[model samples]
Target: MSDADAAVGAEVDVDLDFGDDGLVPAVAQDAETGEVLMLAYATREALSRSLETGRAHYYSRSRDELWEKGATSGHTQELREVRVDCDGDALLYLVDQSGGACHTGYRSCFYRRADGSVVGDQVFDPDDVY
Candidate 1:
């Protein structure tokens, strides 16, 4: 790590920002392509791991553990930048993605049919991804 980045990482206080549920919103965007890929949540360890490893990591509230996005599915988000909102309750992740960001074989999780009411079109079955 560069000296500047190491300094910033060391000073980041992740515990100061988590919500009551111990979660902070993490917005993932494509670093090179500039597309928003998905949104998730990160707990303290997840945030720390992301900073240390330069990979997108998050907390799965349902599973109650730190998870690296796409870890099992062979798609990964390589962290480019992580920014906190003014309130520190939310985070923006700039990443370089490998493979589809969504388990459904799409580049982003935001893929959905826009009928008048916002319908979803499932492109790939969940069984195929996990």
Candidate 2:
């Protein structure tokens, strides 16, 4: 399925190049504002679930399982589009996000600067959750 098809929760029929580990890098972006929200890995199942549910799903390498983006924190990423790079090795997920994407309570995972300064104010407090 194309990104437009995925946005409407249709089955994706595009080619994908999964790595040897059976995973592919997936980048999540803000659908309306064009902000990069986070980077994660997704298995085929994850991709299928995202398309089936209209929500983002990713394979957690650290946890060794599929996870829905906002299952715990309520910071769900509503899938809007899914794009495959020309090489088919990477994916871009455009989403309508709710709440902060970062576990640290930031709107994005890339909230820190290389110089050790924060880019902007944090949107939420991690202490309230896990």
Candidate 3:
């Protein structure tokens, strides 16, 4: 067993490389429910924090800052497992979610249809969060 693998409790870090944007894709899923909740971006710091703290953290491209999930919304994700893709360009965060993972009151951010259909009925209101 290698030192890095033991430190991360994983097989290996496929490739710890990011793009010029300094961002890598992060996939968040419900640890117990086995449902995909959200997809965000994580910088090196965010990934380190998530691994160290066992909480989901992300980098907001729009805000250009670190985002600790549920910091203000009270919907934090407790990290259960963190995996880097073979290419190391993406991550998977399995977590125990508290409150609604979706800003729309759903359990996940992937509440919309993939067919490009219009959604009129909202499960939750954004006003409640923002």
Q: Give the higher-TM-score candidate: 1 or 2.
A: 2
Against the reference, the lDDT scores of all candidates come to: 0.77, 0.89, 0.78
lDDT of 1 by residue, 6-112 (tens): 32353475535786788889999988778788888998788888888777899987888889987898678877778888888898888878877777777878877
Per-candidate TM-scores read 0.79, 0.92, 0.80
Q: Write the per-residue lDDT of candidate 3 for residues 68-129, one digit (tens) a residue.
A: 99998888988777888878899898888887787777777777688966443345566887
Q: If both were scored by lDDT, which would come out higher, candidate 1 or candidate 3?
A: 3
Clashes of 2: 2
lDDT of model 3 at residue 102?
Answer: 77
CA displacement after TM-score superposition, residue 7 of candidate 1 (Å): 11
Off by over 4 Å in 2: 1-6
| Superposed model 1: Cα runs more than 4 Å off | 1-16, 113-128
Q: How close is candidate 1 to the true structure, as a TM-score?
A: 0.79
> Candidate 2: what lDDT?
0.89
Local distance difference test, candidate 3: 0.78
True lDDT of residue 94, candidate 1: 85
- Which 10-residue window in model 1 sums to the lowest lDDT? 2-11
